[model samples]
Target: MNGPEEGRIRLTVLGGYLGSGKTTWLRHQLHEGQFARARVIVNEAAETPVDHALLGQASGLCVLAGGCVCCVAKAELISVLRKLCDERTRADAAGQRLDHIVLETSGLADPGPIVAAIKSDPVLVYHIVVSEIIVAADARHAMSQLRSEPLGRRQIEIADRIIVTKVDEAEPAELTKLLSTLVSINPAARISGAVKGVETALPSFEGVAPDALPDLNGQALKPPVAPTRLQLDDSIDWTAFTIWLSALLHARGDDIVRVKGVVRTPAGRLLLQTVRKVVQTPEILPEQDGLGEDNMIVLIGRGFTQSQLARSLRYFAGKR
Candidate 1:
């Protein structure tokens, strides 16, 4: 559907491995009324959505049962998103406006395809923009899970932010190792700890910038070491950047877990992010001097060398 609407609905995809406390974190958010004006889409693998039931008294909550939204129920997800947007639009005319959308993917679900579906769909593209991918990692089991399950690693790799759940139950050293492993897998992501009954703010990516994209060259490879960050000296050609990024992600999405940055384009400052192969359409930011002029791009991945990544990004640099 085409529209002249001014505001796009912001979306956050919550995902993680099974038993990672995704539902527990979500329940906390709901009880705190953080999603008071948000339409929540709950995807469950079973015939009935237990998560939806647990979220009692939550307005605008909808369920897509019997399958994962990232795969089997993607079409239903699209339909539900459109319906939510339409309903909110009508509701706004009557005085209540929905502020955002929170999609709770089944714990075992891969969020890449769900993100792709939102960006590629003709109708949803005009209405929704994914803000971030948040994954809940169990502090006690994450390391073991990562060793055995490729899915577990992928979830960590794609996250923009990770909430380390069950922190209170984990031993100090185990928590340290888990956090370190998380950094090794996806250094671009911000890691936070969560415990039941202790309130932790629902992680948001708004106005957050990479702390230090560390250069890994000649350094002893270690867990929790920072990933390399590349800053272009000049504003990039948006078309050129898009072309390069699309090709890069298509070719190495599995290895290159998370990519996010702000860039200055002829049109404006744009926020760009991707999780694995699912690239979000760039969102325009307010025009301001020195905004994204640094052309900072942070890349987090495994197995690839720094020189290789540097070589790939070199073309995007403006002529000196």
Candidate 2:
């Protein structure tokens, strides 16, 4: 009644480089019957979470925001997973059932941590499984982005299935060249092609059957690796953080593909998530307990200095 009573959940991960159209493909899958009772995690390492806003309206989808479901937000992700599991158990008590979990990583996110998260969280390990890693690539930019951007390339290399987006816009020769290049980089992935408004290439989550995940026997879970935590004070000056972020973005615009975070501003706490060269306006979320304890932000890109980023935000600590 509440969650899935007795059914198979196809857990899928959709990943791609910036502007590679991962969101477009995910939107298509969410609406199709091929998917049922889906949970999504949109990871953006910036002030605003654009994807969260994009997916918020999906009727059957439940989303967890304010952190990527990877290293940075691993704790939060665990918390979310535990809560969902508890919900399932409660539903089971009431003779109800829930469906599946689908995670969509930000373009700049590393799928490794996400994989690691699913494997490591004991409570989640019992309820979820790593069904597939679907990586998306821009047909026009795959070669250069894969060769030059480690983050982008890692997304492609780790995929069980790869989807090449923007094929319709590319010249026929260009699409062929892109596919060839991607193969050279990651020969293990199963590659498919798609363009705008195309759903032919993306896989349906429904295909992930209950018996599919043999690895999740709910026996043992590995201990989690330690994670670094960043917390900001209630008096943080988000204006300063914004100014500093702008300057940092200007300096590393090429490397900084996205920035998203929840910060305390003079007016109130707001959520920010962005794409490269596109900073979304802050959105106010319902006030909750401990919202300010871990004032989190993510800086996703190459050549980024975490210390420098932390240093810049230290100004928001109200001590400078």
Candidate 3:
């Protein structure tokens, strides 16, 4: 393979389905200094961004929320890339030069469109070279997602690297099935595994049976999944809040694909998230004074409304 041109900047597109652990994997890589001197750009579907808070290790970071870069936000992405290129051109110090750009796409985005946009854009085409597309696929839910979601299938089909995340929690047989399916769909793509963002070995699926993926007519999708932001205030009682969340997940977990929140409490800042019905243990984040986005929750799913969620939370907390 030929090396990149002298002044061109390499951009890596990290993508995956909802709750597929894209941030987790990217965080680990940044911590390990894999992408040295790289600038990170995060595109989130929710207006109130949460995932970007965890990626402080990047050399630089920019967040674009409330739009999917593949469709709704392509122009914004191009503009950002052009700005980065201009900055690189203007930098004189050796340490100030950016080695690469890591764009973390919204979970709902289609990598194909994003990739196409960069290569086809008149200005971006001259300044940037797309390095690769790294996609993270959830092991526990890959089967169902691939079978039904056209967007999910497109993400996998175009990835250069497919990371099967949450491997430790997935069933062995099902994991094998997912591996087989991924290989069947994208034979040229390299496959690997990760547990809670740490790299691991993928078991051999030499003869495992791949699930028969149904032919989704592209329009047969369920209602589009969107992010609903909810506010958490000091007036809310803790016990009632727990009950409300438990009840909400219990009733609508299938419809609610991902839940992520960063809230401030007497103890410290807590990062809480869940994928489907599985609730992950909360982790404490470093204290930051006057974090504006604190006490906010973003639920990404279909079959729900913003007012309905806010009302339910308020009712359970006895604040309404």
**Top-TM-score structure, candidate number:** 3
Query: What is the lDDT, from 0 to 100, of the residue 11 in candidate 2?
Result: 64
RMSD of each: 19.7, 10.4, 1.8
lDDT of 3: 0.88
By the TM-score metric, which is better: model 1 or model 2?
A: 2
Off by over 4 Å in 3: 1-6, 92-95, 289-292
Give the poorly placed runs of model 2, Cα more than 4 Å off: 1-9, 60-67, 200-320
> CA lDDT of each candidate?
0.70, 0.62, 0.88
Q: Among these predicted structures, which one has the highest lDDT?
A: 3
Q: Please count the clashing residue pairs in each candidate, in the order shown.
A: 0, 20, 0
Compared to the true structure, candidate 1 yields what TM-score? 0.60
TM-score of each: 0.60, 0.61, 0.95
**Per-residue lDDT of model 1, residues 1-320, tens digit only:** 12444478889899997657776688888788777777778876644333453455466778776667887788888888888878878988887777689988876588888899988999888878888899999766677668655678889889999999877767766676677677778989988888852444433333443323233355564342123465654745666667778888899876665565666677766666565666756667654433122366665556666567667666654432
Across 1-320, the per-residue lDDT of candidate 2 in tens digits comes to 23542243446777777667786677776656445466665655443344554454354444444445566677776776677677777888677655667777756567888878877866666677677898888766666665555666678778898888867666656566667666666778888877652645533223222211122235364232111223555665667766766777677666666565566676676766554555656677556533223366655665646675677677644455
**Overall local distance difference test of candidate 2:** 0.62
TM-score of 3: 0.95
